[model samples]
Structures are given as structure tokens and as C-alpha cells.
Target: MSRNVREAVWSPDREQIRNMKMYRLMEKNGIADYDEFFQRSVGDAAWFWEEVTKDLGLEWFRPYRQVLDRSDGAPWPKWFVEGKINAAHNCLDRFVKDPRARNRLAVIWEGDDGEVRKRTYRELWTEVNAFARGLKQLGVGRGDRIAIYLPMVVENVVAMLAAARIGAIFTPCFSGYGAEAVATRLKDCKAKVLVTADGFLRRGKTIPMKEEADKAADLSPCVEKVVVVRRLNRKDCPLNEERDIDWDVLMSNRKALSAEATDADTPFMIIYTSGTTGRPKGTVHIHSGFPVKAAFDAGYSMDVGVGDTLFWMTDMGWMMGPWMVFGSLMNGATMVLFEGTPDYPEPDRVWMIVDTHGVTHLGVSPTAIRALMKFGDRWLEGHDLDTLRVFGSTGEPWNPEPWSWLFEKVGKKKVPIWNYSGGTEISGGILSSNLMKPIVPCSFNGPMPGMDADVVDEEGHPVRGEVGELVVRQPWVGMTRGFWEDPGRYENTYWSRWPNLWVHGDWVQVDDEGYWFITGRSDDTLKIAGKRLGPAEVESILVDHPSVVEAATIGVPDPDKGEAAVCFTVLKPGVAGDENLKRELVTSVAEKMGKALKPKEIHFVSDLPKTRNGKILRRAIKAAYTGKDAGDLSSLENPGAVEAVQQSSAN
Candidate 1:
């Protein structure tokens, strides 16, 4: 642990604390202490979630008889039992009911070629209703699955809301995925319909997405219809007369449809997250479960509310993409959906979007920051980001250098970077930074409200001041109901670890000051010379080198030490990756992390495999280097990187 990160750099003033929604929630509960508020939230979850739903103004056709039902078991505890609610209603109908909110912008979309589109709550409601009616016309209804494979656009959001409007479960595939990946999800969900765009632009090139969608639809025999959104307006766009239907034609009926009066526990989404070894796990989310948790985290923790524009650089498939949608709309905030890379056209595109959209809360991945930082601060010159109030980060652990650069340079040391950490199963964040407290660099101040999170040893005993497994003791509202049609795997994956304990698979530590930091995935832990190690520790030290832009570390089998560390690095542009540079990098990590943890080998690569959301695929890299089967690579944004790692090992 770095001593420099021990002291908090940013603290909320009296005025700032008073303005925070977290403070208001605490005040409303008559709790003077923030810590006390968290205690009550986890100690009495039923009371806390009841207040959360009431505070969020979540609409319910029939109120829940109880806040939580745990008789089944800890892993499968039902939330908001007996309540009739609709996700679309909470996101749109409630806002449209108020005249003042009806005219507010619900979604602001920016295309790759400088095209812009905006929709108010009333306008979005009309579009969503039209699509919902169209889905109903296709015989889609409650319990049916609709697969969405479209770029980041207003229509993607509309499709999601439309599916929810009719009580259909929707599964979103990464826009960058190929046919096999998309087909896997479609087949797993056994979707009745597939929504996709003709194509999309990226880095001045038109990617033919329809072809992939067509191939995937062909593979997924259960797909009864294909709805194509004419994004690029291609005259040559092929349409299978038997199965494909134009989006506009499908929406010929512009009549409105009522939001489905769904039971709160009814599954609305089946989001698949890639696992280390099998097919992707389909994490099931419900109407009140994901929406409520996302709303509370955004509204209370991130301080998003009416008039705040929230933009996260992500694809529709990732949890954060859906999280941004439900969280922002549910809070009456505008969601900014951009359809291009952050560095495309210019490295400043991300900053430009923030300035152009008046974004108050901006979220990004640490990998993106590391990639953007290579361009220097010249890209951020003219954009006046005066409207940005908070910076949100997730996806992976942050190295100190990029974290400091984001805080000190981009934020001008004024805005707080809330390091948010969680999985798709958690709906939002397990650990999040609170505006009411001071923040340490790259560290979460505490767990999100109602998360009974703790760091535990191998035996399940709580451990502090050292790295350990991150576990949640009590069931939270956002917990995934279970893996779709695979309850046994879900139970074995999380609950079987230690009775009712949910082992989240991440290595975490709480320092003496009570600040939390995730080291890396517990399964990816590098055991060297009888010492437990985290890949982030080695990667952080390697990235500190000026020549190295990004790095990934993994443990390989060793005859003597049991396991040895191997490093893969992507050097800065124009930097040579000769043996001398590799030696220097190896020495640098050795000097910083002691000689025992020195990388046995360092290989230079152009890029590392990552998810659409920009999380480095360390397990994939290890699998490739070891010539092991890399299972379920559907989430990888760059399959070519795997071959590169494999080639490097052969060298």
C-alpha cells in the first residue's frame, strides 16, 4: 500500500454536505451521523429499502405486503413481495404525469459523425408505446424474451423500455460482439425477437452490424422476428422477407400502450455476465430490484437528480449502460448516449460531450483514462467542463497515476472521483464514494447503503488492514434473483462458499482509516513464493513507467516458487519494445514491489483484450499464454489480442 494514498485529498465542505442527497436521506431518518445511517441501513434492510422506495417515489399499482421475504434462503430472498410495479412506468409514466417533467429531456444521443438527437419524456413515451404495441403485435408478452443488439442510440433505450412496458424480459448484447457471441445470448435466453440496427459508424468506418445480427438470428432458431432500425439508411440493406421487419413498419401503429402491471419480483432482464470457465451466467433482474437499487445509488450516492445529465461511455450490453438508463430516468435526469469511441476523431471527444451536453455526472473506466492520458492534456484545452460536479469510475481497479491525473488535471482537483465498484449481479455498486465524506485516491470510502460488505479471510473470518476476499453477509435488494434456469450454479457460485456468505470473487482491503480498495479478482490472484499477490499491484507498478501505457500481469506455473509472475505491456506510441526496455520494466517492478515479486518475463504487445466496457481480460490473457481453453470469449472486444498473447508465449 502506498503511504501517499493514506490521507484524504478531497473533503466536502459544510455547504456541499448540506446539498448532498445522502445527507438529506440521513437527516430525514433523524440520524446525525453518516456512519450511523449506514449501520441502520444494513442492520434493518427492510426499513431502509421501504424508505428508499418511498424516497425515490417509485410507483406501485399494488403496494408490497412486505419489504423482503427470506424464508426461501439467503441466496434467493425475494424483494418487494406482492407488489405490482412496472419498470417502464417508474422510468417514464411517472415523469410524464408531471407537466413540469414531461418537457424535460429524457435522452440525448450523439452519433459518430456529429449527428445529435434529443427526446423529451413525452416524446420517448410515445416511441416506447409504439414499440411496445409492435412487440405485442408480434405475439410477445409476459415471460417472453427480447434480445436487443443495437448501438448506443435512443432506439436502444426505447426497445428496453418497450419490452418492460409489456412485461417482456430483455437481454442486451454488446454492439461490438460478433455472430457467435450474439447467438449465444439469443439462444440462452431463447428470445422471440431480435432488435438490431442496419449498421453503425466507428472511427470513420461503417461497421455492418446487420450482417452479424442476421447470422446470429439464423443460429438462434427460436428468434421468430428481426426488427431492423435503419440507422445508416443503407439502400443495399438486405431483408429476409420471411423473418425481417423494418422498424418503422413495425411501429405503424402509433397508439399508446399501458405499462404492464407486473409483480415486483417478475424478471424484466436477463443480463449475461461472462464467467471464468463456463458459458456466461445469465443474471436475472426484476422490476423493483435493479431499478430501485440503481436509482438510490445514482440519486443519493452520486447526487444525480433533476436537470443532471449523466453520461457513461459504454455499450448497451454492459450493466452500466442499463444502470445509466434506469438510474437517470428514474431520478428525472437526462441520459446521454454516445455512439463512438472516446478517442475517435479526437482524444477530447469525451470532454467535448460533457461540455456540450452540460453533463453533471460523468462515469468512465480506469482503462479508458489510461488510454486517454497518453494524448496529453492538450486535448482538454478549450472545453469548459464547469457543469461537471462528480466523476464516477468502475469496471476495474485504478492505478495511482491515472487516478491522480483524472482528479488533478481533468477535474482541476475540485470535483470528486467516486470510485464505484460492483458487478452486474449487484445492479449498481457494492462499494461507492460518498460526497459527504473525504475521498482517498482510487479507493471507495465505504460500502453503498444497505450492502453488508466485509473483507474476509479464507476461513470466512473478517480481516482488516490486509487483502482478503470481499463478501456480502446479508441479502440486498439488488442481488440477482438467480442465474436464469440455472439456480444450482448460482447457488454454488456465490452461496456455497460459506453458508449464506456471497463471495463476490474480488480481493479487497480496508485500510486503518476505513477506506476500501479492491486489489483484483480473487480467482486471478497471483500466488508467488508462498505470498498471496494481486495482479493490480504488479500492473500498477508497471504502468508507473513512463514508456508503458497499460499492463496486465498473471501468474504462470513454476518449478521452484510454485508460481511465477509474467507481465504483458502495451508501450506508448513510437516507443521501441526492445530487450533493454523489457529489462528496465522488469527491474522497475522488482525495485518497487521487492525482488520476490519481480516478473519472470515481460512481453510487449500492441493491445490487451478487454470487455466492451474496457475491463482488461486477465483470465483470457492467462488462458492464451498457457494454451488453455479460453471459454466464453463472447465478451471480449478484441479477439485478436488473444492471438497476440499466445504468440508472445511461443516467442
Candidate 2:
């Protein structure tokens, strides 16, 4: 265990950094050091993005005269003004002309049922063109909304690229989302076409995706056409004769169509946030904005290239899914798509996939590492992960335990674990670890080159060593224009708190060394006896105990102190939730966090409620314990865990 805990520095060679696109661009512009170069880039973002776009050779039909048009306001800034380009052309069409990339595998997908599918660049081009024509045939024109509800299958990628090909906006719903959640996004966007699959396998069972799609379509009156794929030849596949059509039948014997020419700022997608409270906000992204932003993150931040096969464990609905797919393809890199849960069949599936596929870059969540660590290091030692070059993670804050496990067990203490922190509003990462920088255990080295990210108190004053709200001082290319319909809600959610500054919900701390650490969401920070602490600090200590599998801490009301910390824990499979064991766990936390910071009550449950993408929902547990409504359980992958928590807290 001690071997797993140490700081690692993975610095690239001077020649390697010199060959990178960012470094070459910086050299061309006479910039030398990373800090000075980044300062100049954000100091004048218009010129920086313009240079990067041209450096990356983004194919455009018509170019723009001006770089940025901030006529409206900073919040509504327009990027690459008057430029005409299609995201599909930049991602697929341009690759077709290059012989090296034309036949390379664009996507490699694996299903839970041992089914594997592969597509090359040429093949992906044909399918995307055919699907774009199919969408046109179904009356989907430019600016039309198309919603896709499918698993991580090839069709999911096809649907997204096809929608962007024809200049239509697409919304992707999580496969695990219930009907109401699906209905809300589709209805809000007023989707004209819905692409869904009959079913997909999950935990050795089939989930009727088409059935849920049907339920959502029934509630969404704007849906004019339903396209269903035959994932499972089940007898009960829903068929609406009037509006529904077969996916394979529509694409049979059809010729590929030409790509659409669209303005750079044309609307591309409307993704909803998986927030714990209230209705999910619909964030609007543009073609030039998100694709360009994602490409920058991949090329510069993650150092992914054509020779790399990048795989990030994500679903179609989350922001990272679209971010990875579009970013990897635009860079002419191969992408790996898994259609099953990571821990199904066995716990070492993550390591197995890297070994089998020879993936060069991998991304996962800290929540997943914590769950996998409980199965022991033997599972990790079974596979050879020498192929992995870079390790990346997001979704939640990392604990030293799981972060160390990932660094030592799988990464062999050699690969750099780049910690990225961002949200759906920003297309990619705001804070990221660069190849040139030495990574701390669980810290972001600095803000990504183009973002003016900072930590500030309630008064909007800069602070160090103390937790504060994370904010972006300047607008970037990928900042969402606004919410779907309600400008007031969008403004209130982000800009209302501070003047001209975008208020990110997370609370972060910048240590004396200038390394940034996000505590958690500001709302989730526990304030006990006037001393505030991030739940991650408490949960990290609890998860360090060998018997604990996962933990979530929240501040509940108390008579003596203003608030008291209460922890909900999920034990290992064989570990019993006896009083003796509970007492020892409480004492352990006290020894680590001091007596005042110790949890007032400790409850053990069979599991912790988390989203399909594996984000522990502390707010949901608190709501369930206090008899408040758990708002919007659409992203809840395991409602049974919430029920377990409720029952245990009551006892």
C-alpha cells in the first residue's frame, strides 16, 4: 500500500514537445515558456484561437474576415465570425483524402454480449453521408432538432455526426435515463426525429431501449419520425406504424450525400446538465465552438495524435462522450467505444481493455477507481498496461487513495495522470495537467492555456489556501451561448452571482505552491461549527480504510454545533455493518481529521447511489434521509441504493 502513494513526474523529451502542434505554433509566434505563452494566449484569445484553428488545418468552405465579434456581450460572444465550415467535413471528409487516415479504424466498439464492431474512416464517411441523406429524406433540414437515445453503439456516433453533417442540432440522452428524463430534453428541443435501438445489454440482462424511447416519444409531440435499430431481435420491439421506421431499411442501397456548408457559429447540439437539484439546464453548443475546443484539449492538453487509440469510459449523453468522439476524430486518431459497464463480468475489465486494444490514451472517473480498488491489486497485476501512454480523469474530485491506486497499479507509476476539471457549459477542461508540467498527486498544475480560470471568495476576491468558488474571468470559444429558451435562467445560474465572471459551481483551493485542488461542488461543502470542509476530505479518509468500499459525507443540522458531519458508507462484499466495525471506522476518521471534524453519525449501506457515469450523489442521500424530494432521478443508475440509504438512515 505504501508503494502506491508517491508523487510522479512524467516529462516528455524536448524533441517530443517541440514536435507538438501547440509547441510549434508557439515557436512560430516567438513564444518560449509555457506560463508566458499561456498568459499571452488568454491575454488575446481571438488571435490565439485563430492561430490554432489555422495551425490545426481545420477545413473550411469559406473563411472569416474577423476573428471575434463581441457585439452583443461577453456572454454571447461569437467566434470565428463569418466562417463557413461543417464539423463533419473537419472530422471525416478531410481525412478521406489522406491515404494514411482513409483506411485507419475510426471507431472500435465492444458490446457486453461479446459483440465487436469496427469502422474505418472511409466506412464512417459513407455511413455518415448516407445517414445525413436519410435524415434529409425524413424532413430533417438545417436547424431541425434530432434527438438520439441509444447505448454506446456505432449508431450513436453515426447519429451525432449525421445530424451535424446536415446542419441539424442533436441531443443525446443517457441510455440509463428514464422516460421522463428523455421526454424533457426532446420536448424542450422540439425534436423532429428520434433514433433509438431496440435494446442493449446491461449487467447480463437486456434493457428495452426502444420501449423507453417509445414512452418518451409518446410524451414528446414534436417528434415527427422514429428510427429504430435492431440491436436485439426481441419479440416485443415497439413498432409505431405511422411514425416509426427501421434504421437498416432506411439506409439500404442509398448513395452517400454531400456535406452541408454551415456558418461557424451554427447551432450543433443542446446537452442537458445532470445536476442534482431542480430541472436540468439545456446548454447550447455551436459547431465551430465545441469541436475546436475539444480538438485543442486533445491535441495540446492530452497530446493525442493520429498514432494514438484514445478511449474514455463515457456514455453518449455526457459531455465527455461527444468531446472525445469529435476531438479524437478531428485529430485523425482512433477511438474505442465500450457498450457495457466497466465492472461487468469481472472487475479488471478496464486493465483488460487497455491490454487487448493497445490503447495509448485512457480516461476514467475517480469514482470508478475507488470501486475497483476494493477487489485488490491482484486484478490489476493480471494485465500488461505498457501500451498506455497517458492517463486522464474527470467527473469528480480525486482522493489520494484511488488516484494513487490508478497511478501505481495500472499506470505503473510511469504514465502521467492528467487531472482535468470542467463542466458541461465549457466544452472541455478549464484546469488541466500538461505534459511539460510535473503532476502532483491530485492537483491541477494550472489552467488550460486559453481559459482565465481562478478561485475567488463570495466577494469575488482572489484567495489562496482556502476554498472558494471557481470562476472563469474571460469567455472562450466553447462557452455555451445560453440555456435553450430561458436566457434569464442561464444568466441567473452562471452570471448572476458575479459581474461578467462565469460562476462555476465547484469550490476550489489554490495551495501555496500554486497547484489547484477542487474540493467539491460549493453546495456540497460541509460547514460544521463555522469551519468549512469539502466532503471529499472526509470521504477520502473514510475510503482509505481497507473495509470501506465507498463513502459520502454531508453536513446535517445539529443542536450544539451549527452543523455536524454524517457519513454514509458502503462496505466491501464480506464486511459486515456491525457496531464494532462502525466504531472503529468512526475512530479512524477522528484520528485523520481531528475530533471536531469527525462524523456525528455513521451509516452503512449495501451500495451508494450514483449516476450511470459513476458520480456519487451526496445530495440525493441527504434528501432521502431528511424526507425531502430527490429532484430528478433521471441520471440515477441505481435507485435501489438510494432506498438502502433511506432505510439505513432511518434505522
Candidate 3:
């Protein structure tokens, strides 16, 4: 075993006091061993989930008479049957009721202009109550959808909690999304109100979010009002009085209002996931068990506890946004919200925030780490990162180079690297690394405490030591109720493949030691001359080359090979992207996987098309290379990336 792996096995971090409840409860039950836990959790799912819900402290108005109501088939299984409790209540009310939590910091906002703002539990309650009153004034009621298109400022967090506080369903669009993308989500949810900002600062430049809001409003006729927060101090931003209201004025005279609890199964948010083949799907999450599960996972798996300042580089539009908000705050941990680009002013801006806030747990994407890796280790060598205990990564598969760099430099090789995997539908991580387990590079220790996850072959049989589809055998508290107004689509998308199991659309594998490795999306799996290959495996091999900075792989049609692997790569500085370099990359892949999986073509490019949340858009790359219309260019961080790839391919 490697030195890091040996150390992780010999000595794992002990769980803090506030984080040990779930493990203790699990031990109280028959899940004393990890192997036995995995077996029983998947084989006897109903009993596993029933015990989980209670151990996690999920609130329900009426107790679920049964753990699951699968009479309607797995596609439409009813979890927490006939239960009623508001998610906002579980996140906010419970925290406020704890006398020790009243004075603890709930959120800490750090602006790009070097301004810092802190809000305690008492203060956050007032802000949420006032914003909830404002939402009520805009005629938002139970089950109504409220679209939030704001920066990662304090107002954005307040808007989501406020909407949920009053039983309204909140849907957040990433501030980086363009008008059409925002319009599609708002129209799909039939949003009644939009909370936006006049503009926001990014890399010291003013971005006009209100303009996009106006264009989205023009497209979405269901939008009744737009609440605008003053972020950039814009004087002449366009505004419609009949439909647009100043956010500050809306909360000026509003008094603190009590939360109105709703049914446990009532929709809390409509999070849209960019589907591989179609437009984004609005996955609807509910009130009852999501908060408890998020909090429990953050505490137990990530080791976040009271007084710890946590910061995950994410926006409200992504799952990590809601995950950070409920997870950290519910455990009485202060959350650090950053409102600008991570590399603003300098490449070390994120490191500065960590040092400034004494942030204990830092969550970010692998893309961010890759970008920083290009700058060398000196950028973080002199910084004081002693406050950090754990580092979290998500969004995409991480390369061992960047993953190890994060551990050695930022963590001093002591802190645990908590690699988590799941989608917006699962609310938080279904498979995550726990504090008590050894964390290998780019691998999960195991499934979360209650999740019944497995790597299954095409025949629905368990597979060990080989890549297969990742599926959940049982339902958990945080699973999405269904896609909004698209029950048929949801059924066909998730449930049709594996009979009662929820196929999570990821290609995963389990080693003999039982550690899980995710190999990109299952839909992105390519059959090169009838042999299955995962894009992540090829990409990981490419990234291992010292000359390569980043890489993305996709399958393009080939008359001879049926479907051939095509790789696009961005080289490190001073590394020539010539014919010899291309041949070297192909040779590397051939040696790593096999000659059968060798790429037919290797195209050098400046960048890859990725979402604002840092997920590479593999479908866009496939469509671009195949001459198919690249659908929905709205979620891309660099729309020009596709054009660049096309130009390079032609050359």
C-alpha cells in the first residue's frame, strides 16, 4: 500500500462530539461492521431506511404507517408515507430553539470588495422571517414556485430559506446562466416570483443579472414579480414598477413572521439537472427528510461541527448550495459565502478566505484544484491552513495528481480528503468518504450510512472489481419525489432500467477492498469496436501525463471502428501541441487501458465546455464533433469552447 493509504488505514481522524450521534445509533442497531452494514442495507432495504429516518431525527406530522409504499411500482414509490412536516422548520426552527445556537454564527458573507458580514442565529431568523413576509406579500403560497437568479451573496441564501420557510418551492438558477436557460427552468416550474440582483461583481467586473432577468421575464409569462437586490450599486438598471420591486424596500418594514409548517412530502425546491440527451429536468425535493439527511451527512461524513466555519465554492443553483446551507447551519456550523470568482484579485483568493475565516472544512470542485495546480505549490506554501481539518470535492471525477496536490500542499497530508458522489436528485452525497475510513485518491470509502448502493452489471447482478452501473437498491430520505410534471419522463429515466432500483446513471466500480470508484456518466460510456469504455478512465490516463493540463474524451462515430474514442486536450504552458505530442497521448492511453480503447483522433484545444458549476459538458463535445446541433448552449461556462473545438478539429 502507498504511504498515504497506509497512514489512513493505521490512523483515521476521530469523530467530534456533535458528529458521533449517527454512528452511535448505527452501532446500536446491527450495523456494527461496514461489511455487514452494506449487506443488510441493500438486502433488507425497508428496515434499513426505517431505522435511518428515526436515527437522523426526521420530523413528520403523521408517522409513516409503512416505510415505503411501492404498490405503485418502483417508479412511483412513496417514501415517508402520509407524513407532514416543513423542511424549513427542521433547518431553522430547531436551530433557533437551541439556546446554545442562538448566539452562534449562522452565515458569514465575504464580498469581493474585501467586505465581511456575519449573521448570528437570532439575526438570521429575523432576516428569514422578513424575507418570508416579503414572499408572502408577493402572493407566494404553499407549493408555489419561486425562481431565484442571484449571486452567491447572503441575499441568495436568505431568499431560498425564506421561500421554504413559508412552504413555497424555491428553484435557483445559477447566476452565470443566460436568459434562455433561466427562462426554461422558470417556465417549467411556472414560477410565480423571481428574486434577482441588479448586478454582481465577478473578477472585478460588473455582470448585469437584471438584464438577464428582464429577458427571462419576457420569455416566462407566468412570472408575476421580480425582486431585485442591490449588489453592484447600479443607478440606471432597467426596472418595471408593476412587476419589479426593490429587494431592500420589500423587507424594510416587514416584521418577523412565524414559520407556517407544511406537509413532509410537499415540494421544497425544483432543482434542474442538465440531462445528457435532452433539456434539463426539474427534480422536485420535499420538506420532511432532506434537512435531516443533509445535516447528518455533513456532520458524520465531512466532520463539520458547531463553531466550524465551512465554505464550499458553489452557487445556489447547484445541489452543493442547498447542501451547504442546511448541512452546515443545521449543525450550528458557520457557513462562508463567497460572492465572486475564486481567482479574483489573485489566484490565491480562496486560500485567503480560508486563512481569514479560519475555515475548518473547505469544499470545492476538481476543476478549481486543477486550475490552481498550474500555478505551482508556492502559492499556498506560506499560507496558514492549520484551521483546515477536511477538504471536500464534487462535480466531476478528480485526477490523482490534483487530488494528491490538494492533500500534500493545502492539508499538509494530514487532513482527510472527503470525496463525495451523488446528483441533485439525491439531495446530498449517496456515496461519500467518512472521517473514520481511509480515503484513497478519487474513491469513496463506501456508501453513506443509510444508502443501499451497489455496482451492478447489465444483468442487475452485483459486480466486484469491475466497472458497472451505480444503483441504489433502496430509497432514502433525501431522494427526489419526482420530476415536476414529468412523471412519465422520470419513470423512463431512472426506474425503467433496473426494475425497482434507482439507476443513478453513473458508471462505478468496486475493488476487492470494497472502495468505490466513479468512472463518469453511464450515458457517456462508449463502445469502441464493441468494447465498453468509460470516458473518465481515458481522461484520467490523459491527465496523468505531465504535459497535459486538462483533458475531455468523447465517442465519435467511425465507419470502421463503429464508435471511436476522440480526445481533446489542453496542454501545460510551454508544452507544444504538435503531432508528436498527439501520438504520445494516444500511446499513453493504449498502454494504460489497451490498444482496443486507443483514440482514433486526438485534438488539442484551449478549453472544454463546462457548466458554471465546473462539470464538463461531454454531450456538447460529442454533438460538436458529430455535426449535430449542440442543444442548450445556455448552461455552458464557455460557449466559445465548442466553436474552438470545431475550429481545431477542422485544422
- Number of clashes in every candidate structure? 0, 0, 3
Tens-digit lDDT string for candidate 1 (115-171): 999999999999999999999999999999999999999999999999999999999
- The numbered model that scores best in TM-score is 1
TM-score, one value per model? 0.99, 0.97, 0.95
Worst 10 residues of 1 by lDDT: 1-10
lDDT score, candidate 1, position 320: 95
Model 2's alpha-carbon lDDT is 0.86
Residue runs of model 1 more than 4 Å from their true location after superposition: 1-4
Q: Write the per-residue lDDT of candidate 2 for residues 1-651, one digit (tens) a residue.
A: 011233444567787678777787788889878889999878998988988788778988898878888888767888888889998889998889888779988999988866788999999988888888889889999999999999999999999999999999999888888889999999888999999999998878998888889899999999999999888777888689998999987676457677788998898999998656678889999988898899989877888888889999989898999998987998889999998877888988878888888899999999888878877888877688988989989988888888878887778778889888897899998998877767888888879988998889879999888888899998798889899987888888888888889898888888777878888888888888777788888887888888888888888898877889899998888888899988888898788777887889999988888887778888888888888877777888888998998899889
Candidate 2 Cα outliers beyond 4 Å, as residue runs: 1-16
Worst 10 residues of 2 by lDDT: 1-10
Clashes of 3: 3
Instruction: Determine the C-alpha RMSD for candidate 3 after optimal superposition of all C-alphas.
Output: 2.5
Q: Number of the top candidate by lDDT?
A: 1
Residue 600 deviation, candidate 1, in Å? 1.0
Which has the higher lDDT value, candidate number 1 or candidate number 2? 1
Ranking by lDDT: 1, 2, 3
Model 2, residue 173: displacement in angstroms? 0.5
